[model samples]
Target: MEDRRRLLKALAACAMPGVAGTALATPASAQPWPVKPIRMVVPFPAGSSPDLIARLLTEKLAAALGQAVVVENRPGAGGNIGTGMVARAAPDGYTLLLTINGPLVTAPTLSRHLGYDPVRQLAPVSLVATSPNVLVVDARLPVHDVREFVALARSRPGVLNYGSVGNGSAAHLAMEQLKAAAGIDLQHIPYPGFAQITTAMVGGQVQAGFMVPVIAMPLVTAGKLRIIAVTTSGRTSLLPAVPTVAESGYPGFEAISWQAVLAPAGTPAPVIDRLYRELVAIIGSEDVRAKMRAQYFVPAGTAPQSLRQTMASEKVRWDKVIRAAGVQPE
Candidate 1:
């Protein structure tokens, strides 16, 4: 009986440390994740809308999580370079991506050999914001509204040229979609970058082009460009006087440039959910919303499932538009 008691006591003693270890594990370590800085990669230049929105949200996020959120610019390949980087990054919560509509939706459609599958290789964190594309013309253009612009382009055909930020960019596709919908044939002149397109539009190098509201609003307000139509489902608060393309004639025309946050595809569910919770909070904050509006963007914080649906729908729609426009990949 004594030997049996000693054996039982020894077994109990052996199990004590294991039970205590489990109990004594620090819950703070598990709960207080993101002990280090978070890096957000932006696939565009510094002053671009994506960069502006990223900085705004990062500032708030950093403050909330007690970690520094740094933005790194990785512009190239029409946003593919940076996007690819994020798609190939470690699934840890530290690395993330901030990208616009083209990289997330249109690029996958246009580029047959994209290195990463946007839907399958990246986990959508949140929809940051979106800006309507504004159809802007040189201040010296002869047309004042969409009706006259279409008439003038139809009359001139291939003579009246329009500038695009790049060949497969959203701006280019928006203009092509408009042309297809309106049955007007304007010459497409591609520019190396958005800055050049703005310069060309302002200098009368190209008669008109489709640009994000943030990019063209200053030009319009300063009287360097004329806003004829906005490519949104409805009129924008920033440019309430401008008519939508649908209202102009084509009843279902809408082209918007949007941005979103994503992490690598294999990121753990725990990490993804945590990041998403924080992101939704950051994006929906009054300060972040105001900053986005000041940049001529509408706050759009969508869940991962919602973004997945958006990607599927947008891919189908943009594919048809690109095919109709006869856009060949570079």
Candidate 2:
């Protein structure tokens, strides 16, 4: 019993005011945060939008944090592998998750057997950006507008198909949400990645698809695909001519994939606050804004509490859509 008491005293001493204060203050002047390179785990393969953003953010964060911020891709099982890894990783503010909507919100509701609970295992630090999906159809499609497309899909039922980046992906869920709201019956086709979605979409294999504007915009400009509407709350400045789906008659319709930084749950509040402060500084820079604009994402550096609220609201929203669509884990 005496030995146990001594051990407890030793642990308390380590966290005491003077000792804890010194250790925490060591990373200031003549010192650097993350004396070693930090790793940003991306749950998708390279070249994908999320992966590209992760790399961009890593470069910027590395510069801002005065350490190399490396990105590691562990793509598999619809992003479950990498996401689970970060969820169980050390909460020392060194390892972080740079990802989009799936692993954060959709995966938990869809994959009932997933190893980690997103809400319980991770905490949001900062929101990087928000990107809306663009609704585009092959040039050969008869439909010309959102209304016409809805009519055609309703008439054809399962004949006309829409492609998404992958099953349970943000694109898929967006389309599912659209279908429910419009009461249309279009067939859903899943692709392995955006590359396949592009190929199939341009070749007329899939009549329509939901893809990021940056990617589909080039095809639309090339006359390979015709963009019908922007699936966001307001018209995108990039495509000023395209009307938003909400304006097209679907009230309260909005689907956006937000990228953000997150640390594992149980990370000390001070650590989270410090990281958030640094990230906000970096994200607010004009250089980072330029990078985000180049990638077709709107810069949105929200507070930690605001990001948490957004996540909770998003979970509630997607949970309804997933359940209504009868989507289940594979």
Candidate 1 worst ten-residue window by lDDT: 20-29
| All candidates: TM-score | 0.87, 0.84
- Candidate 2 lDDT at 279 equals 80
Per-residue lDDT of model 2, residues 68-183, tens digit only = 88899877666778889999999877888888877777877777688999889998898878888888899888878889989988888988888875567888888888888898
The alpha-carbon deviation from the true structure for residue 213 of candidate 2, after best TM-score superposition, in angstroms, is 1.2
In angstroms, give how far residue 36 of model 2 lies from its true place: 1.5
Best by TM-score: 1
**What is the overall TM-score of model 1 with all chains considered together?**
0.87
Report the Cα lDDT for residue 198, model 1.
Answer: 82
After best superposition, candidate 1 residue 106: deviation in angstroms?
A: 1.7
Q: CA RMSD for every model?
A: 3.7, 5.9
Clashes of each: 0, 0
Q: After superposition, how far is residue 87 of candidate 1 from its true place, in Å?
A: 0.7
Per-candidate Cα lDDT values, in order, are 0.83, 0.82
